[model samples]
Structure formats: structure tokens, C-alpha cells
Target: MAASSKRTICIVSPGTARDNNGNWHTADRWARFLRDDYDVVVQERWSARWPAPDLLVALHARRSARSLGEFREYHDDRPAILVLTGTDVYHDIHRDSDAECAVLLADALVVLQPAAIGELPDIVRPNTHVIYQSADALPTLPGVPGRKDVTMVGHLREVKDPATFMRAAALVTAPGVFLQQIGAALDADLERLAERTNDTVEHYAWQGGAPREYARDAIRRSHALAVCSTMEGGANVIVEAITSGVPVLASDISGNRGMLGDDYAGFFPVGDAAALARLIDRSVQDDAFIATLRAQCAARAPLFAPEAERAALLRLVDNLFHSIPSIGKRT
Candidate 1:
């Protein structure tokens, strides 16, 4: 391990605290985790105006590409850990030159889920490691006595497919089935659609952004989580739901499959609102099916424990800073 007396670590997140998105959440958690052993701080990006730390953990490859590239240019002796977000792995790196440069320049790469490993180009695969995100367990809270509430939480983004959630809400025919969506209207067009959804769909409610604690409580109170995202590097919400003893009904995508496991029984076809609606109905009426989902979630929850995430992150930093030779050094 590196000497602990005065180590400094910097986290660069594309999303800032005001955004309260997944990237910010991870950066904030890591800052807390490393604060005791290292001088840790979180910022949207690093520039020549600010002091560089001994190490950099950047949250988005494409979005933070300038920060990553400039760090190598300016410092040339330290290490930068480039964390690949969903778009970075599946979309950005393939088409975006900045993302390509970020990967090439990284001393180490972090992918949030195991399955994302296959998406990396062969040249960078050896340097990459999977680090699952985590959420602390919430105290159990009961849902309305018999109501079946399913929730999908994410900002209104194209990749998240909130429209799917809205359509699924309309299609659900099960008695006492309620669908709630919690997210900011990041996209104005999408926000309008959600408004229409709420007005037309009696059981669907689109509650805009809430406090972090309120969101946690909402997840705990819901009977199940519907993660209809089309892409995810790894969603923190999955960890939150699983650790809170909630089962998930997710879209059938590698990201969700990667986090929830291949054998997880609760997947509906991606973007197929009818299929999602059917799954939601089944969750309410079939006790045995719901039990199976609960069992599968319980099995996966250990992988997302706070202790596990903290250890993995620290170990990654220890090896990158202490054991491995630094890359991008000008000398």
C-alpha cells in the first residue's frame, strides 16, 4: 500500500452535486471513503488553475476526456483511473475520439459491471477492472397494505427510457398496480410526455426529483423497482433496490443483465412496454414468481455491500499508486 500520511486523491465527475446523478453519487461516496487515509476532494473537472492530486479518479470517459488528457500532459508522472460510464463503453469509445484518447491515456480503467469487460477494445482490456457500485441497506419499510407499487428512478434521459416506464404503466392491468417515476425533467420534451402520461394513466404518477433521503424511502416503500434503462455502466439504483430487499424488473440489456445476473428471472424485452407491463402484472398476482425474484436479489446483494465497494476501491487505488509503474510519464 502507498504511504498513508499525506496521500492526496482527486475525483472528477462529469455530474456535479447539483445534478445528483449517478456519477456525482459515486464520486461523493469515494471521497468519503478515502478522506481518512488521503486528502480527498471532488470536482467537476481539474484544470491548470487548480492543484493536481497524487491520483485522479475520473467518472466519465468522454465527458472527462479533457481532464484526463491534460493531466497526462501537465503532470506526466502520476496516475489517472478512468472510469467508463455506460455510454463510454458501448457508445462513446466506439465513435468519440475523446473517449478513445481517454482510454489510451488512462493508467487503469474501471468498468462498473463484469459484463462490460467484453465491450472494451482488446488493447485496453488488460488494464481494466470491474468495480460494482454499492448502496447501504435501508431500514425496511412496508408498502401500502396490499397495493403493488413499482418504481423507476432516473433523470429524464434518452438512455434511461422513461417513456417505456410510462407506456408500461398504461398497459398494466393488474388490480392495485401503481407505477411511480422519480426523476428530474432533464429533457423538457420527455417531461411533457410524463405529464401526459400522468394525466391519462390513472395508476401512473410522475413525481419529479426528490431529496436523496426521500428517494431512498420511496424505493423502500415500493414493492418492486422497474429499471427500464437502455444502457447503464452500472446503475447505483440497482444496488439501492437490492440492498433494500426490493426485487427488480429490468429491461433485457447487457447492463441490467450484468448487474442483476444472467439467471435473474425478472427481465422484459428492452423498450417493450407490453412485456414490461405483463411482468409487472405477474409480480402482483404470482406469489411464487415474486419469491423467486426476491431470492435472486438476495443472492446478488452481497456483491454490492458498502464494505465490498470500499475495499475494492481502496485496493484498486493501492495497486495503481503503489505497485504498478505509472504510465503517460514524460520522462
Candidate 2:
């Protein structure tokens, strides 16, 4: 074991920086958040060769199950946290045995939004905690007169439901309304579809696989951010939008409801392109509707602040450490 003064924390994430997906970003942000207090290391997988950590924080129950299971098996005394992603909350936990096993192995469970707790088994509910992700506030770009930009930020993946956004591009007839999609083409078919949409729709553009800074700037410049996901543990993009002073038009789903609140006025039905298009059109034609959305997002902004997220995260870590009197004394 390596000699270290600060107790080490290992974060296991299946995705890497190159992927630029939600899991990787979450793991990276968490590593930054916890670094001030602990020795934090983020890895795609945890291995025995690494110095034993005082705590293990694994993102994605199904994907990180093997590492989480092994860590608990060897270091039963140490705390292990399992963060349930969109797939785990809405899909995998109900059907996947490994995901269920991972749930049981965790000493603490984290859900990105509160509604996700309802998706977990009764046994896991008590241990589950909601931690809304955070992004630093960005300067809201000045809106160009006579132009309305609605931006969607997520990789071209099935879960993100990019097709809905593409189809909505064709349906939206409101002049000066441009639908911009920014993400990597994780799916070849979606890439081709995005290309077709760009060629056919006068107001749609696909700027593929941008750097994080670029994406944030795009969100900051947009009139409203569109989160068209079929599932989301809690979207980091939504937080970025709120912090950047941009409103959101989200898909109506449990995960989104948890993030935006049930009464949020800007939701379109899941996978409904026409409905999404109508919402886009309404946002362009009705300034009052846009103002309402902005006010609602502003009300929720503090919840996603870095200070609040950091305090909640540290509170959880401190509680876990104190619960086990001998947590950092491991050989």
C-alpha cells in the first residue's frame, strides 16, 4: 500500500474523456469536487494493482458492477457508493441481474434526481441519495435579433433520442427558429439522418463532436436548450443551461420531471416530434412563454450550484466515514 495522508477515493466510470458522455463528465466533475479533501482517482475500471482506496464511488451500476463487486468483496469494511444512471434507473435494474447485485453490494446509493428513487427496489430506497449535478454559471450570450436558436446537446445515441429532434426540424415552420444539434455521431445511422436533416431542413445544423468548452458556449448562446432524451439519470446539460441563464425544453419523462420539476411549462411528450416542434414554434411566437420558462429555470438554478452540490456530496461522504469508525485505518 502506498503511504498517503489524505484518504483515497477511487471513482469507476465506464466511459472515458474521449467519449464526452454524461458518465465521463460526472466522474470527472466528482473527482474535481472531492479532490480538495481527498486523494481522488477516476478510472474506467478499478483494479487490485492500485493502492487500496478508503472509499469507492462507481458510476453506472450495470457497467461498473464488476469493479464494485470486487471492491466490496475485498474491502467490506470500506464504504462503496453506486450511482444509478438513466439506464440503471429506467431500464437495467428491473431486468439485469448484475445491476440488481450491484445495488445490493453498495453501502450507499446515489440517484441524480429524486424521482429515480421510485424506480429502485424498496430495499435500496432508504440508502439512496439524490445529488443534482452542477456546472459553473456562464455569461449568457446576447440573443441575435430576429433569430431563435434551440440547441440540443448529447451524443447521437438511441437513449438520447436524437431522431425526435431531427424530425422536429422538418415540422417547425416558425421563421428564424433554428434547431442546432451538437454531439458526436455515436450511431452511424443517426449521423446519416442528421446529414439528411441538414440538407432538407432550412433551419437545422449538426455540429458534430465538439469540445466541452464549445458545447457550453453554444448552450450559453442558445434561446433555449432542448433535452430530447428518452431517459436521463439527471442531465448535466440541463444544469449547464440553467446556470448559463438559458431555459430548457425537456422531454416529459420521470427523469426530466425530477430535474425540471413536475410543473415545468416547457415539456413535450416523449418521442413526439410534432409536439416538440409545436413547443419550439410556441417558444418563438410567444415571448411570454419563453419568459415563463426562463423564470422557472432561474428558480431551480440554486439547486444546481457548485456550492450546494459540493456540500451535499461532502455531507454524504462524511456521514459514511463517521458511520464506520475504522474507515481510514485499513492496511
Candidate 3:
């Protein structure tokens, strides 16, 4: 394909793609979105031997640090977009040298949540863009409808705080309520927690890893989504819940707040099982309050719709290609 006729873009996500959990899936979603307009290749890793593309979009600064460095060394003049994941934005950028290098090496930075940009150093602030993740609601399930089911969707990991949701479910005094967690247990400790929670709480069930369709169906069928995360780079669960018309009870972190809005009332302090329990109780017992949260989530749902995300991404790509003198030229 001729250089001008075919726009080649490469996405580097060095994390294990087999897991297909969070950031890996995010990279896949963005790749699918870009595929229509550009020739896009998604790879777990990129090396010096890889062909140079017109643009590179990489996810997870620390995980793809080597790939980012290689891309920079090999394609210095090409525009590279580095997407900051929860770990990359919250943990690695502060402590990991490779993560910091990825930030400096990129022509532009992408953060899923608005608050994530605050975590970036002032040097890269100008180039950073906040692009919220998107999801589509699946067809409604055929099961019983009236019983309120609170769902939590995330791979069981330390950062995700799966225990918080389980503990909250156990502590919830409300009857006729269920707390379902659907994700693969990525950590041994979390697996133990899930097992224990299942044995102890009659209402809590850990339905180990389901396909994305099943997960989305769970979200659609649920009364609400509980996001008890220690940190996030704008979780896709929040977007998924919003788009599915399910209210959210999220941790009071900037990442959650960035997606749920700073003024959104459905927030509990991070890692506070008691607070989460209280929120769960209130969501079930207080109809007015729950409706208010639902309304707030509904108001913000359009921001995460597929159309909005696609437009913002295309605009970003167009601006990058047009502004960069070398890449815009048809060879």
C-alpha cells in the first residue's frame, strides 16, 4: 500500500493478551475503533526489528516500557501515543523509571479518566488527552427481574479490592439482595478471598471468569455496579454500567470520580468495607437515593457512548497527523 493511501498504525500492549482482562481489552477496543479509518496492528510487544508505522499507540507504560523505548529509538520522528492504564498512572509513573521514560518518549499521552491527567508531570501535561472508555448494552436477560442484584466486574486482583465487595455483601443487612462478582482471579490471595466469601455469604457468589458477553449481560441484569478499587485509570466497568443504565457505587478516588463525576453522590471511601456495606444497604433500602444516583449516571452516560469516543479519537489522530510535518507528507 502506498504511504498516503494506507495509514499504518501500530498498537503495543505488552501485557499478557490471553488474560483479556482490563487494559489489554482497552487496547483491543481502541484498536477496533481505529481499524476502520487506519490500518491498525495490535501486538503484545514491539521490537527494533518491527516495521515502522506512521503512528504508534501503546498501552501500559511500565509493561510496554521496552517496546516504547524501542519504538522511540527506531521511529524517533513518528508520532507515538502512550495510553496510561490504572497502574501506569497511579503507581508506576511515580516509582518506575521505565514508565516515566514512556511518558517522555511519547508524542501524545492518553488517559482514560480526566483526573488521571493530574497525575502526569507538568512536562507532559500539554500533550495529554482524556478519552473515556465506551461500551454497548447487551440484550436483557430472561431471569427474574425484581430482586436487586449488585454486580462487580473486574479481574480479582489486589488493586481491584475484590474482598471489599465480598465483605460489603456479607455485611449488608438487606434481604433479597445479591452480590455477584464475575472475573478471573488473577492473584492467589484474591482467589482465597473469593472462595471464603462464597462459603460464608449466602448472597455472594464468585462466578469465575465469564466471556465478555456474559459479563455485559450481568451488568445489564444488575440493579447496580459496585466499584471497590484502590486505584483506576477510569475503569471500563463504570462506563459499562452507565451505558447499561445501571447505577454505580464507586470508591472515592480521582479515577472513579473522574468517570462518575466529582459531585456524584454514590461514592464510598476506598478500601472501606463498612462504608461499602452502608452504601449497598442504602441503595437497596432507599429508593429516592438510588434513583438520584441512577439519574446522575444516566446524565453522564452519553459521554461514554461509542459514537463520542470514536469522534474524539479520530479528531485526535487527525490533529496529530496534520500537525506533524513529516507524517502528513505523502511519500
Cα error, residue 329 of model 2, in Å, equals: 4.1
Over the full model, what C-alpha lDDT does candidate 2 score relative to the true structure? 0.92
For candidate 2, give the lDDT of residue 298. Answer: 96
RMSD of each candidate?
A: 3.0, 2.0, 1.9
Put down candidate 3 lDDT per residue, 66-167, tens digits, no spaces: 888988898788888999998999999999999989899998999998899889999999999988889875434543456778999988988999989988
Off by over 4 Å in 1: 1-4, 324-331
Worst 10-residue stretch by lDDT in candidate 1? 322-331
Candidate 3, superposed: residue stretches over 4 Å from native = 1-3, 137-146, 328-331
Q: Write the per-residue lDDT of candidate 1 for residues 111-176, one digit (tens) a residue.
A: 999999999889999999888898998765988877888999998888999999999888999999
Cα-based lDDT for every prediction: 0.89, 0.92, 0.87
- Global Cα lDDT for candidate 1: 0.89
Off by over 4 Å in 2: 1-4, 329-331
Query: Which scores greater on lDDT, model 1 or model 3?
Result: 1
Report the lDDT tens digits of candidate 2 across residue range 1-331. 9564777899999999988888999899889999999889999998766667999999999999999988988888889999999999999999999998999999999999999999999997899999999999887997667788999999999999999999999999888998999998989999999999999988899999899999999899898999999999999999999999999999999999999999999999999999999999998889999999999999999999998898999999989988986767544
**TM per candidate:** 0.95, 0.96, 0.95
RMSD versus native structure for model 2: 2.0
**How should the candidates be ordered by lDDT, best one leading?**
2, 1, 3
